[model samples]
Target chain A: MRAAVYHGPRDVRVEDVPEPELDGPDDAIVRVTHTAVCGSDLWFYRGESDRDPGSTVGHEPMGIVEAVGEDVRSVAPGDRVFAPFKISCGSCEFCRTGLHTSCVESDGWGGDNGGAQGEKVRCPNADGTLVRVPDRYADDEDALRSLLPLTDVMGTGHHAIVSAGVDAGDTCVVVGDGAVGLCAVLAAHRRGASQIVAVGHHEDRLALAEEFGATDVVAERGEAAIDRVRELTGGGASHVAECVGAASSMEAAVEVCRPGGTVGYVGVPHGLDGGLDLFSFFGDNVTLRGGVAPVRAYAEELMADVLQGTLDPAPVFTKTVDLEHIEDGYRAMDEREAIKVLVEV
Target chain B: MRAAVYHGPRDVRVEDVPEPELDGPDDAIVRVTHTAVCGSDLWFYRGESDRDPGSTVGHEPMGIVEAVGEDVRSVAPGDRVFAPFKISCGSCEFCRTGLHTSCVESDGWGGDNGGAQGEKVRCPNADGTLVRVPDRYADDEDALRSLLPLTDVMGTGHHAIVSAGVDAGDTCVVVGDGAVGLCAVLAAHRRGASQIVAVGHHEDRLALAEEFGATDVVAERGEAAIDRVRELTGGGASHVAECVGAASSMEAAVEVCRPGGTVGYVGVPHGLDGGLDLFSFFGDNVTLRGGVAPVRAYAEELMADVLQGTLDPAPVFTKTVDLEHIEDGYRAMDEREAIKVLVEV
Candidate 1:
């Protein structure tokens, strides 16, 4: 089998690798039909994260179940499915509470939970971690693009908006116009946010954000962006979704939120330290919510949305490549040339 | 009229000051019947906060309305009332949403918001800012002490527990043993927390916390305290109320919250900077809520609890002093000699 293997920073190659097989009673072998390059992938491809050499690095993948262990009940061989980035036991206290992203036994593919980037991926705890794709939308390419995000980014974006309690007729400000940020704009729109502000310096991404339902865009960063958001939203945004995990973006999210509003952050933090200003947080009564997305929890809902055409998140995919050119897809994402790159297996 | 005035750090003097008078159409002048020395008052008394010299330093006071402006309707002359430490115009958007502390027209008594605090205090937006004392408990000394915290600490504690979403049978952790922290312990108890852990270093405060329904007390600080809380609560507390505004306390609160649980903070931050960790936050799915307390929103409920004897938070007051001895009271609190000090006018 061939797999996209990480060799070093900005170095990846499609190399012949041993095919994944069902190892545990609950494991399933997925023949990758469609996988996407995520913004998180840039972390390892750019050497920003601790990526082991030769590790397979994809987490967003939807495919047909080529084989399944005896214990797998919900999914069977040849069944189309969407696997969440984090695999969970689904019975842990965290999972029971719908926090599958933080499932006690869940593992992230290629990161801390082991690698998954390959033509055939092995998923453990298949019954709890894999959601079968409905037949009505199996052939819908756009719906498949939407499925890729459900494994991570789109679910994450929805988590950011929902956890922040973004309701109808409310104003929301999204920091960082990356793929997840754009998805958040969509999530906010779907959840009935009356006004959405997408803040970023990337013109193309900002335009995509508008297409995804952003009512306004701020090209500035930090305090200037916050000031503009405040000006545009009358006083300040009722909810702020922080999609970039940097300290500056988090601070700006807090600053742009109206007193007593909330800031939901879903970005992976790098080089950030310390706690929030308790005085300002308390003085303004700001609520901050975020963490690993409960992807599995939202998988069914997001898939239903995709199937029903109520949400069209496929526009976030700016590029697509064959599995053989997965390396180039990673590079394009790392260089910010594509909002999201989908790899066809 | 005699009032407690701050001259400098460690320098408070009871001096003759001009009596307060109605300054706005919605203002009402009140002769303070009782004033409590708050932990925040020490901030100005110790010159920790940027406060001007000669500023009258009391904010938590219950008084009899002496005069009312033409537009004052809810509160009239001779009515006994309690006003939150922060004065707010109820018509603001923030106020309408039950966040009176963040009201656009709200002002703190001494810190930042320039307003008078003396033997006679003027309350603006009287109809919305003042809570009338029930006649049945107005003359009860203990009941009046209960009203003291309603102005700030107790209300703040309630806000913390409420924000943390402490439900019946859930385990809660209260960090800090100050007035607000102890009050949080009581608030969680009132909410039917099955087990409550009060983390603090002081024995007297811990005892008060225990009396107020803290089932366990963790005397250790930092990671050690977190470990104790985790061990005591099986895995970790379902909710944590951080009442100390330090970085270490905030970190501890976040560390002890179970995945999907909440960390509510009410303490005023001293000098903490930086934002929460996004990667860990995103991975854990923790919710952080805190800010200026919605005291006015909860005033009626809390007052009813006090009048009905379902809550007895007045035991937190360890000392009583005449207005002339306010300086000594401040020193007692600064030195940790008193849990809380109440002043009689």
Candidate 2:
């Protein structure tokens, strides 16, 4: 089997790797058809993540099950499926509470050895980890792209919106213009946000955001961006989705939210440090909620939306390349030449 | 009129000040019968707050309505009323949402010039701010003391529990041993918390916490406190009410919470740098909510509880003093000699 392996910072190579086998009765082998490069992937590809060398790089993948173990009840061989980034056992207390990200038995697919970016990947706890793609649109490229994101990004964006309690007719602001942020705009739209503001400095990304249902785009950064959002939404947005894990973005999200509103942050904060103003927070009555995306919970429903054409998340994939060009895909995303790079296996 | 004036840090003087007069159609002159020295008041008295010099200080008061403006329809002259620390117009959007503390027209009763510690207080928006005391319990000192704390501390404690969504039989943890924290323990008990952990180092305060229905008291601080709470609760607390506004206390509250749990913080954050982990926050799926206590909204129900003897939050008051010795009351709280100090006007 061939897989995308991380060697060093900014260095990825397509090399031969041992094929994954069913080690447990609940395991399933999936032949990768399509996989997308994520912003989080850049964290390790650029040597920012603590991930070791030669680790399996991708978590987002959609394909047909090549084989399933005896205990795998729902999914069988030849069934199309999407696997969430964080694999859970589906029976843990945390999983029962819809907190699969913190599931005690969950594992990140690619830790030390390259996992999902390979042609063939093994999924543990198959019953709880895989969502079958609807038969009618299983092979549709756009539908496939949309379904891939549901495994992580789109589901994460929905989590932010839902956790923030965004209601129909509420004004929402999305901080960051990455794939997740763009998805948040769409999520807010689906949840009936009357006005949505996308704050970012990139013209291309902002344009893409506008297409995804951002009512206004502010090119400003930091406090200025907050001011623009406030101006765009009368006083301030009732809910803000902070997609960038940077400190400045978090501050801006909290600052721009209206009193009694909420700030739902999805970005994994990298070296974030700042004291939240309890006085201001108390005075304003703001709520903050964030964490890893609850992708498994939303995988089934999000795939349905993609199949029905009610949502088109594929526009976020700026480029698509062959599996052998996976390194260049990582480079394209790292260099900001593409919003997202899709690899066809 | 005589009022407690903050001349400088640790320098409070009982000085003759002009009696308050009606400034608006909804204004009223209340002869303060009982005024409590709050922990927040000590913030300004100790030069910790950015309060202006010569400012009158005190936000918690239960008094008689000596005079009422033409627009004051809810309470008549001679009516015994307990006014929430924050004065707000009832019709604003924030007030309508039940967040009276964030009301656009809301203002604290004690600050640069607004002082409820004075013999007479000019309560703005009197009709919306004052809650008439039940006549049956008008002379009940225990009930009145409990009602007095409801004007701020008790109400803030209730706000934390409510915001955290504490349900019957849920496990709860109260951080901080201040008046508000102890009150939160009582509030959690009243709300049906099956297991409550009160985390604080002070033995006296901790004992009071146990009296208020805290199932256990963890005298350990920081990470150790979190460990104790987790050990006692079998996992992590389902709900956490942060009554101490310091960064460490807030962190402990977040750390001890279960993945899907909520942390309600009512403590005013003092001087502290960045401490909240936003990245880990998303992964944990913790909800953070707090701010000013919405005392006005809960006054009626809490007062009814006080009158009915179902809840007695007055044991928290460990000291009583005449209005002339009000400075001593602040000193006692500042020195940790008293959990709460009551000043009779």
Model 2, A50-75: lDDT tens per residue? Answer: 76777767998789998999999989
lDDT per residue for candidate 2 within B151-220, as digits (tens), equals: 8889989998988888899889999999999999999999999998999999989999999999999998
Query: Per-residue lDDT for B1-345 in model 1, tens only?
Result: 888778889998888876666777998888887888888777777777877787778888688988998998888888889889878888888888899988888776643322234578878788879899977776777789877788878898999999989989989999999989999999999999999999999988898888899999999876788899899989888799989877678778888888888888887776465644344445688788877678888888998998888987787789888888887788999998988888888
Error of 1 at B93 (Å): 2.4
Kindly report which residue stretches of model 2 are placed more than 4 angstroms away from their true locations once superposed: A222-224, A275-280, B111-113, B135-140
Query: Please, what are the lDDT tens digits per residue for candidate 1 over residues A1-345?
Result: 878888999998888877777788999888888888888888878888887897877888688889998988999987889888888888888888898877778776653223456688888889889899987777777778877788888898998898778999988999989888988999999999999999998999999898899999999866778789889988788789988877778778878888888888888876576644345566788888887678799989888887788887888888999989888888788878888888898
- The alpha-carbon lDDT assigned to residue A310 of candidate 2 equals 89
> What is the DockQ of the complex in model 1?
0.62
For each candidate, what TM-score against the reference? 0.93, 0.94
Can you give the lDDT of residue B310 in candidate 2?
A: 93
